[model samples]
Target: MFTPSSALTLEQGWQTTGATGSLQKLKKFNNQDFNHLRTSCLSQGVLFEDATFPAHVSSIGPNLLPEDKLRRIQWKRPTELQRNPYLIMDGVSRFDIMQGEIGDCWLLAAVGSLTLQKKFLENVLPKDQGFQDGYAGIFHFRFWQYGDWVDVVIDDRLPFLNGRYLSVQPRTSNEFWPSLLEKAYAKLRGSYQNLHGGYLSDALVDLTGGVQMAFSLKNPPPDLEEILKAADKSQCLMGCSTSGPLRRNIEVRNGIVQGHAYTVTGAVKICYKNGWKHIIRIWNPWGHGEWKGPWCDDSPQWDHVEPKCREALLRNKDDGEFWMSCENFQEQFSWLYICNNTPTFLDFGDQHCTKWSVDSHISLWSPVLATGRNYSPGAVSMNPQYFFKVPDYDPKPYNIVVSLMQKHAEDMHNAKTLKIGFLITMENSKVLEQFSRTRDITKYFTLSPGTYAVVPATTEDQEFEFLLRIFMKNQDYNENSNFPPSPVLPMDVPRQNQDRSYKAVFLRYTKQDSAIDASQLQQLLNDVILQDEMTSLGGRFSFDSCRGILALMDLNSNGRLTLQEFGRLWRSLTKYMDIFCKEDRNHSGFLDVSELKSAIQTAGLAANEQLLCLMALRYGDAARRIGFSDFVCCMLRLETMTNAFQNLAEGGSQVLMTAMEWLTLVMYT
Candidate 1:
């Protein structure tokens, strides 16, 4: 199974209001740090070229068409493409990206929808690096992969067909952000050909990392216009797609690209014939296609509108964006996908949309444990299960959105995919949904007050990875820092395996010595514990961490741990793990100050309010949450300090240690 990326998103924090998981940090693709490489290139006076994702034929993948074989594709930099290349000429608009030879309009459709978002567009595409001053031919873009947002970097060498650019083309001759952003995405998915055809929602989720819902236009819901208006007010990304063999991209006379994805930028009603007309603005990713029907750019329908209204609504340009009546939109399009980080437009009667809470969890489908629902119904019991509560604070039923997305390989088109689905079991009743090979499957439930178990499984027993996100309405994200301290109490940690292999493992690390130091202990611990468990247990113990452990457990003050001393340390570690897990309610691998206070108290140790604040400042991350490693270090220091003071104190609080003792304690821990 693919190991989840260790890079957690520091910018997009996990607000654990009603969510079960925290966001994982995003790592640089192939461990290539963009800033570091750019600096190296500048210092050396050379343009940067990414060796990891090199600009070669292999990066384009195999030829998939007859026309594709006719062109001699070569990688070209912006300086080679055009003179005075600007990353953004005028500001980024909705019509910047013009499609090229590739048929990945679905990808561009997603990007076009997000172009309407001016409030946080820079978050998705950071506009920091440009082709000027600090330019090193390197650019970076962030995309939401599965659950976490990952920053993908790429060189400026874009693939060119014959003499023109391949796949994505820039609007203006000098503007290159559109092409560069597309290149970054292509690098992320392995190749340009890998972007051939994909799910619109997949691209949408990657663009916004938000809740996505697709609606069929064939039977357009009565509240379709209402939903669009709400979505527009909520600043959601919306895309419309045409289906059927008739609309299957080959038919162009209707001015609609059949089987094509189009961005729904806005919804408006104009005063035409003194009647309200619901007009939906749909933009073609090709940057040219338009609906040749009613309310189209050059249609006579504009003559009936008020002059000012017509001026505001009509844009008689072949810039790929057009205004069409809702009736025409439903006739030409089959599906409309809407995505948003804040899902205020949902069916729930929510007065304040900000009150919603989202929970996310990432896990693997272990072959041994993932007993799927293929053979029998009861097999689902063996799948991994997660639970959440629906309190009875509101009398109305809450609208809950559950989304499951499978993680794919870098070459996603070639990656293994299984029929995956999830089961929601509540009140002894099981609710099952469609199981398909699609990347994302979402379901909506109007649930009352109760605890529910979400059991995600595949059609068979196999090893894979998936992300589960549950959005519950009315769950306020109350991350209060000044939580009341827990009273001094003790908690139980389940005893772990009692295997005799520890003796052999210990001797192997110590090499039959009576005792071992920090480095030896680190190696021994890392080797003995399984990697997955090690990850859950605050990652592998570092030499520095083990050194602190030695300081805490070395009764002789020698900065080494004897076998017997290691025994006590091991037991305490198991207890700390248990306490950490119990307090870390979101399973985010980190604990806030409130959780830290509870965890410290539960481990048969209590720090006053002042000490807890000090610990939070000392060990917590930017979000004021302490990671597992830091928590362990804090615990060891707390214990050692408490013991040293007690051992030399005349009163409970006063202690006087010798200079040598103080030096040794300060130097080791």
Candidate 2:
């Protein structure tokens, strides 16, 4: 049972599935399965070269050199670069990830922090791989995309410009894991060029499948030290950056560079003979910068500390790792990003350490529905809308984070990202973020206990896919979109005249086997639908639209529909015509949303606000005017999907399916 006043709970985010169960299992990238590729290569005694992400100029991308062809670049295997190369010399460390020519300090910052924890490093960098035994010149690394951990396989080839590597370089000359790991990361993204500039938060999440919480340090929080301490104690990856353009790498002040990204190693309160000092451990991914502020490696303030403390905590080298007072840290850094496997440490109720629950809904905007938004109520309603309740049983409103991440699409190939944002429809607090065209936009909300609707949309009428995730604490949280089931309507068959006309058109175009291909179906519909001027089309049915209709109605999985399928469809089509005629009371030649909703209910179907809004988006034009042909197709789709659900449910009250199973139903149906 659900109530408007009920406290809301959240479910875990949905992720990709394959041979999933253990940490070893992962979704294959570029459709290349690791085990299969490894076995085949080992059996054939051949080196595994991934054609998907080949070591070519295109893979390198044009961003590297102003004139890529003009540069003397060489791609060599690790063996060619070093005499006696070992995959792991002693072990991975922050020192191993020294940035060379690439401008991906954001990624390097995340990678350096990744080396701090053995658990995450093991999950992302599988240990069973090496360059010596069974070395096939093939290696794979895992990164979390959307919600899936994808195994990105790459060849050991690294690019060098006149003897120097172009990307991340390892400290030990003979150790090659760091270099190979960087190459694998480059492969995972489109290219090293794509990784040239990015957000540390994104890299951290990709490395851990964690929730990232970003806090601005300009006006730092009162308990900021406590927050950092909790994150470090929980082994969460932390990072910070100075105020600058995200892509700028030039040093500005106190050895801090504008637009540069750095990793936070730890937060500690070190005690000297006098008192304790709050220190923030910072690491520059560049492997060189030094902060000359108080409490820094060579600061005069270090004279107060004991030799053991100085030896253990202070390092007087250019290793990029330095300590700064929390006060200076807050003043200098622009933002502090913390990425935990799951955002559970920030819970203020220390005695009640309940972890957060998260659920993700993967959706897309199609051309018919992708009417980018404005403040217009109808326009806002047209975008994808999801409703979930939040439960805040305690006196204080509970903590929750909403993340909207756009999946990479064709537009991104040319470096295009759609400006995307989402709105929260709830009473009291209005949680929102200024729209930006980035990979992911996250906002944390402290909402009062109640149900709420989350609406995610893009800025243009261009098709783009996205994932909307809701993370919250507590229980009794679920969605009720399918509530208030469809009511039965009077079942009617095609009118006698409509039936005769459809049969005549079918006979004229269909084969002797009483079947019609997509082209025939298009011709037959065009010929028959216009016989009576009552059936007005916004536009003529295109060849592509005809093909889509055939696919939707194709039950036997054949290319064509039989006479029996056509007959059943004819009845629904004519019935839809009756409802349209009755509801288009003003004879405007197009049914608006209200008319369409009435028509849906008259045809014995669900006409909920959310469903009708989607219907208006799909079938209705920009003005939300549903034409005769559009009405018939839309109603038929609703009915077909409804029947599909009923068939699957049979004796059950509701349908249940795995993500893959649901995908099959939605794709085929």
Candidate 3:
């Protein structure tokens, strides 16, 4: 019994071997290196960021330096650092000290979030330092989820809020301007790191924070006041409308809101260049919602709610806040609406047609045309034509069909006989289908206007070559010859180009009664011709090779070779020639009794010596003469060499002869 190796066991063995060759082969088969796997997973949505947990809060006490110590730390000497520092860079605050400045804030935030879960960071950080520690601050890290380990290099320069700023001078001041630093960091919000630029939303999400949304400033809904009136005590929603030219109206229905809206909860009063006024501050969670407020410098509502509402609303607004006015609200919100009431047609008439074709038959169907007009009896008629074309070498049949249409007013005078004629030619033969009548002849068909019909091709022979043609007759005029000429058009006929023509003929043959072993003879003839051709001496041969072989096989002259004749010819060539060799086995100038016995034994026919001798006597003259050529031919007539040889070994002389004949014929031919 054979035991198969388990893939897991084999892999474990490879891992234990620590062989570079085995690992390389494994990577090749898996189609990935560590870095490739890591990048692929990252591209598909893996995110990593440095997550800083408040040391004191998480029981990991005092992981970062005190404010004074942080201010005194030598930024230039990262290797000398004993504590971490928290700084606001870009728009967000992060704690991870990346060695090199990378523009990927989103990825950094994800890394940070993972750090919050201690296990994640622990799993990815390198375990061994070795010689890899000093050069380029290189460290090995694994993208644990992707099962990839890669080396990363850290640079000295740290990312500052405004730009990548080198810590040329370490500050020793105890009181540092953190606010100013925060402002500077905000200014660097959109800068590029490495090749990628920072996207705050992505970064926030990476940090395990919520994603930000975008909001557009637009006029509040018209039903704002109504919606406010219907507002329940629990529903703290109010609406406001943007003041501008009302380009369009949004319809509110069902429970969906048709237009954009935001929750508003703030107001402010300020003195402007024009005058003192009131302005409403709106917060679009999307982060950029500014209100063209009544509280602005020239607003008439300035004195009424500015100061009081300003503070109240300001307190209400936070990271995710919105604003609206009661006047612009709707009792119900809906995103769909009804526009103008115009007539529309739901049904399309008979403009479409379906067709299916298989083997030699092609079929088409056309339904009644429904053009949204009054219906009339027998308003449309269809006549379809099928065309067939055969490929140059392929023996399969190909076809196409065309449908023609005839209407009453189109041919008023000759309504009873719609005559459409098509010329036939070779090129158009393959176009198995076509439409006789089209709304636009130029666009649809290659027919000229008022031409009755256009010939598809240039040859009359091709037109008449069609195997089948049937005219679609209307029931009322089924038996009438004048009932519109068959809508099926013929292809165009081409002008005579050449006078050459050819014909095909057939022949037949019989089996047992045939004189020559047809199969063997044919093969022999082919071998002779091929050998001569190969030697460049074929031209010297008198007989036409193919003609001769066909004539020999066609024994009855009936234009066909029967199965019996084929089989007999095959068997003859493969069997029957050992007898001739019996007389000349020793080549002693004559056949001695001993030489004959040796020949019979060598041919594996010793047990049938009497039979062998009898056959030798019959084929050979009284002098027992056997020519070399006759001996070779006889040997070349065996049906199958292996079977004949087996029979000869069993003391069958006839079998030996048959086997020799088969082998000789096969080899020589």
Candidate 4:
């Protein structure tokens, strides 16, 4: 199985000085160091071959990789036999090293920066050749506030709960190392979580023992290069400098920056047609701050400010105090130091923010019409005939005012006074109360965006529809004048007594004819033909048989055959057969009575012998020669009778009477 013991090794030449101790004592004092060693050994075996790297590792940004060969690394799980037992990597700056969730990032960055400061990397790092080795005499790094650092003795055992050891299976234990590292960093930063709660500046302050500051993305100072160098040199405790006019006030009290602190993390380059622009990356140690500067290319401040504002503001070297960069800088000189950091140009391509708007209307009264001497009982037709068009503006809240008016017809001859009430519907659905008479109608109602109101007047005996007019006016407390004419269209009311002549004519025709017409009769014949064609064995003899038969019968070639045409064809064929053949006594080409009977028997209709006899009698001449017309008529009559009988059997005596009436009409017509 894969193990971490052979994966990473210390630098070739390094040494440690300390007495060896038992693993139990090491576990009691420093479990994190031991866990780190164990994880390293596990990583070696699990990730031995380049192609065996873990999926998560491969998924990291490939462009950021040190070499292309690392891309194809293979990963596997470590077995119990190949585990490691040490804490620190050899030949590295341990003082600056930090661990994140893997708890190593802070330490790593610190040590990485310190290694940049001095080339004595091997002196600070441990001397383990394999995955685990005891770093015996390295002095512990101390935090300024804590005043001292705790001794981190090497150990080989990890923390357990309820006196029970955790399972060392790779699947289960693989996550333990990273989690421990994360916890350590969280504790160092004084934050409980990664994304929230703690201050990022506080972590930096604790780690670096220096004052921290945050800058806005919108209005960053143009002299950022000077400020960043100053920060690196530890010249200013905290600074705020800009190349242009101050966008907002910096609220500092008692010579200290309060609430939160942040530090510059990285730089980004933004490119345009002419050249590239630089933007500094500032992170709030607390992880939250208001940087009222142009964060991205489309920042509004970027549009208003001049290109000179993107340059570094001049600073005074003699006093080392903060300075603001503006046209009136000489007059507003103060004892403060404002430093600008180095500019990092960002390549954030084609990103922008969009804005939209909304509008609304309020109703004066309910739209429901009440029953009275003059008003109708049903629902009032208060459908607004008007639409309110929203203007091109930003979404904001505004109040609407509605007025009510009632008028009575002044006629001495008519005794009753018209007492009409107004009902209103907002946005065509939200109903308001009815107002009977003119009152203080200027009632203010609040509305958001995308709303309109519909108002109508009605009385007790008759429901009258009215247009819902709308108007817009300024919201001023001192102004109490009439509003201007509404820009929206006037409401349209539909008349109740509109003409419907076509409907009346259709109803009259429907009442006159209840029987099936030519169209329906043809449909029934076609349905029967289709059913016969589908069910019979002979129907499958040819693919186009049904289509050919239908076409032949359709005299007009309009893709349909009428019942009259079908009946006529049957009659003509029967008549021709009867006229050409005499009654054949020997049952030859001409069918005699007995030969017809035998034919019926062979066709499985012998049980209806009486019907067969009647058919033969109807079709045959006095000389006993059968005619096609008579034969067709007899067959049609028998089929009609069978249908009538079946309907009667299922529907009882009433259907039987109806069938009789239908048959009589069919035969006579």
Candidate 5:
């Protein structure tokens, strides 16, 4: 509970919206400031100033006893609802929430499930708030939106039908937290009408800054018991939904409501006379309709248990809470949404909860002209890329998780959600290795200590804003904000002198006829090679190195290089040299295992353990090493493959690679 003397101004609120700021500098809210902010906002006669409510509310006609139902509507503050409107009644529990009319049981179910975690509930509702003790007509709640916990303020004007709350009701009349929270959420989305229906995972994500994963009951994981144990250990919030078209309060064939969401409150293995029975407890938001099968209230199974044991179950009448066997639960629910609150980093024996450092950027995806695809080339590279540097020497085990979230469409009521997906690749020496695909907005990968590039893109051509999030244990990155750089490669040529020299070298080597034959190209390679340079292999350039360079430069077997083609090759080689020098930390003119990994990653390629091992075996010397010549060979092969991929994008002839060509390219490279 927090009670600030003055509320944050509109501009101040806007500044807090995911702005870069010191964590220590943040004005953290507590029980006292919760009430303070509300009082301050009320005194100013302004709604809570936050992004959720960017503007004033619009006017809409209210109906009493309209066609939908026979009832009148009223608006009231908490004090008006009761003499002592404590934020919560006796205790916050699933029973405290009851769905009212709206098809937002998914959200209400999340609220109900959230109560099981006391700390999380406090973070959202702030126990210090109530109608008494300097009452105000405004209240505030916090929601985890995008990558930040945002404070949303709202007036305590709740809609009531026939003198009772309309959207969501409480089990007890004095318990106003459920209805008030619903109203605040409704206000966040613009209006009460916007809260009609939504996914449970969406609501859970808003309530907790946890990763959401949904499991389809139709193909449940075989290791479900282990997954559930882990989820319980992490205190994950869980909910279930049945399949079928939604009809208000309509029960399906076996007394279970179709298309209704339910909270998974508890899982237990209780002992019976013969053995043990695994039971799972679920609560319906409608406050009615429960499983009446075995393990349920009044079931014969209870007869075997002692009176005290049976009393512990606390079976209640029509409370919308009931226990069914885990087996039955599988048959009843179609989908299960689990909000995993597990810390992304390793737990170092600390009892306190860990909060992940979250950062996000808003960008859009557009169609690319790859594979001869329609639309713009600029759009084809719509994928945003991020670079992460992981030190290779850390002893502790670590992993990285990337999540891609697209903004919600405003026409959610009528329009269907677009199918969105992304792929993550790690930079191998010259090639990008496919790592993970975006699934459930979260993907995990085991990585060695090195710099890695993550590219997230839409599976199809569509323009829409999206958010990318990175979660890692302990790491740092030298972020180069510009991604998908222009093919002209301006960023690579930062030094004017070096650029001029490289260009002069290319001009001097080219024939006056603006082209050179194979012999002249060979002479150019020899000229570029710096002899008398001590190599990691204890010698100067080798015959094999020269041959590799020739094979790489002669892209077309025409035995000739046009000035334009030679220029492209020269630029690519220049870029490669810069990257190679940065990776060759010892100035050894060769790459060891660790150095090779770094070199591959710096080149924007993904390298897994298997791939790294193969590279070491294929290219490393008898001393288990890779010379500069081999490195160049790898780069050329990758460039060739990339060109082929681009040709595929252009709808050109199918790219072909014969076994002999593959062997000749990879064996020596």
Candidate 6:
């Protein structure tokens, strides 16, 4: 359903310096969607449906595609293939790969790397697709694009030479998935030529949406083994590229191809020759070129190895897989890439460890605003910002990890990565201050419990989508970990004007150059109600509700609410408003039992089932309805009791009160 307007919207100027806009947004499709689209096209008597396929996938007249210039190409479906005619046969594995005529070794190497993570591979290559499920001459695959999951569909038509897949294919002849996936990816970009040569790290990120970190094996870190072991535990896909300057094709030395990408399947410490030896297993995407060094297939070193160990690691028959010592690995591989996936939920510490609350935001930075070329005069606020609140319950510091990623920058910019960075700032009620700034995409910081703002930005002017994930480790924090009490008034304001409600009313009255009168207040209330569906005070704030609040705050006993009275009312309800917002999960302007429990717990109070039921029974009507007013009253009393306890604790009182004692104190306080 991509419309003309959608295209124009994508063409809008961001913070870019050139008029050459980004490519058009490709129409997305899923497995089921592609089937439906195919069905519709077939019903319309269309022989070819190129809507989801690349426009210039095949050459016109007698010409051939750039990648297929040498090979005779023919369009065929999976049914025509000989062998296992399933998209995924015998599950996904490194043996499923077969590099074809295309010079996309980097992509194949990444695919091989993905096979190392079983859970992650299932996510990338969903199991919902199958030719026998319902053949419609179409298939789909999902990829992590920018900050979201995008499904790309393609017609079953694939380029073939004789009866074989012309490009990358699986080792099994009938498995057409690898070929089809490569086609869909080529279509994602403008053409297959665009993907000719690229970094395996870039391909890995595109496939998994994981952050890629490159480590130089030349000067290997002392903790290289520990790092790799940790990566394996985290399910990170690992790959290594031979060291050397960029060249078309480096020479193959001792059966190891220089400047070629290889998958690092595992790093293991095994007992060998009456001692322990550190070894690394690597797989070449070509499925050939076995390493001729030690521990290689048919190497004499295997003769001394334990029978079980040799059998477990023996997959030798020219599959391009080999094992070498960790020392040899450091000497052979130049650059190692670790693509680490971010887990949705993360816990820190052991049994007494702190739990973390995680949240993410997807945003974009425009060169349009980066150079102050937009409406604003100064540098535009291209920096994306996020805020998180840490309660002051514990004096111990909390840890936070902030990761910022700019999506598809390498692919879009011709294998050139975008220069992106971020700044995380800590702020208090009184002032804003710098906490830390880092050019690294991922950074970990220790922070005291307070409200902190995180702003992610690019090092230069560029417009691209980015992902910002913040992980805050707390004892047992909830979604409200980032929400702090809103400030409505400052200390410099006069005591009389300190009341936010009164100040708001005076401002409204002054805007019309009038004084507070009944008619003016009534008119304002009417206007507010008409404009807003509901007020923070409650669901459907009626005229009577407004009057009741005004009357309660009218300390001078004035017939009409004055500015000071309104200010006092507003100031008194600030915390209540915050509670209401938190409790109103669906923003229904009311709180149910579950939401009430959440609010109580967030306020640092006991929220057991019995206590919640008792509060609901006491405060709600027969329908169990807790309106905004009821919520405010309950929170006010609770806050008063909590303040008393805090005061006692701060006053050097180590005494602990029982439930009955607490009730008595609350009843009197």
Query: Sort by TM-score, best first: what order?
Result: 1, 2, 6, 5, 4, 3
Best candidate, TM-score: 1
Best by lDDT: 2
Please list the C-alpha lDDT of all candidates, in the order they appear.
Answer: 0.69, 0.70, 0.26, 0.30, 0.58, 0.58
Per-residue lDDT of model 6, residues 1-669, tens digit only: 011011100100112111111112222432236556667855775544455453334321122244554345677766766543888877778878877766577778888888777756765675666777555666676665543455667776777667666678778878777877787776655455545555666677767756566567887655678667656656778888885433244656678777577888888778888998888889887777878888888788888888998898778688888999888888877877777554211222223334543445555566654322221212323444465555555523325666676554433433234556655455312122222121125544556666665655554566666666666555554445433222111211111211222333455555523236555655654554334343333544445545655555555766566443554444556545666676787867678888887877776666456656766776666866577666655655555556567677789988587543563445332
* lDDT (10s digit) by residue, model 1, range 1-669: 000111111111111111121123455666677788889999999998888678776677665344555347788899887778988887888788998887777788888887788744666677669988899898998887654567788899988777877778987889988888888888877777667666677788888777888777877666788788878777888987876442135657878876677889888766779778889998988888788888888898888989988888778999988988888888888888888874555733445323455555666676675444543345655666655556555523336778887654333345455667787876435755556566677766677777676878777655666777677665432345211111110121111111122333455577656678888887876665424342245555678777877878888899888765775676566567778778888877788888987887786666666667667777666776777777777887776666566666645655466534553444343
- List, residue by residue over 1-669, the lDDT tens digit for candidate 5: 000111111101111222322222222322124556766767886544334332223211222135444324556666666777777667787788878866788788888889898867877876555666655666777776544565556666666666766678877877778887887677655555556656777788778866666667777866555455555556778888887664345686566887678888877667878898777778888887888788778788788876887798757689888888778888988877777544322332323322333323444555552211222334333345454444454423335556666554343323323445444444433123222222225554556766554555544555545555555543322234212112111222111212222333444566224456655555655556433252324333356654555566666766566544565566666666677677877878777888877877787755556556666777667876777656666666655654555566578656476433443455444
In Å, residue 380's CA in model 5 sits off its true spot by 7.9
**Regions more than 4 Å wrong, model 2:** 1-25, 68-70, 245-248, 272-275, 306-309, 366-373, 376-381, 395-398, 410-412, 427-434, 475-669
Clashes of each: 8, 6, 93, 99, 29, 12
TM-score of 3: 0.17
Q: Return whichever of 1 and 5 wins on TM-score.
A: 1
Q: In model 4, where do residues sit more than 4 Å from their true spots?
A: 1-131, 135-196, 216-222, 229-276, 279-669
Q: List where candidate 6 sits over 4 angstroms from the true fold.
A: 1-32, 38-48, 54-72, 161-164, 244-251, 343-359, 366-402, 407-417, 422-465, 470-537, 540-624, 628-669
lDDT of 2 by residue, 1-26 (tens): 01111111111122343321234446
What is the lDDT, from 0 to 100, of the residue 475 in candidate 1?
43
Evaluated against the true structure, the overall lDDT of model 4 is 0.30
TM-score of 1: 0.67
Off by over 4 Å in 1: 1-25, 65-71, 244-248, 270-275, 347-349, 352-354, 367-378, 393-398, 409-413, 475-669
Candidate 3, residue 468: CA error in Å?
A: 59
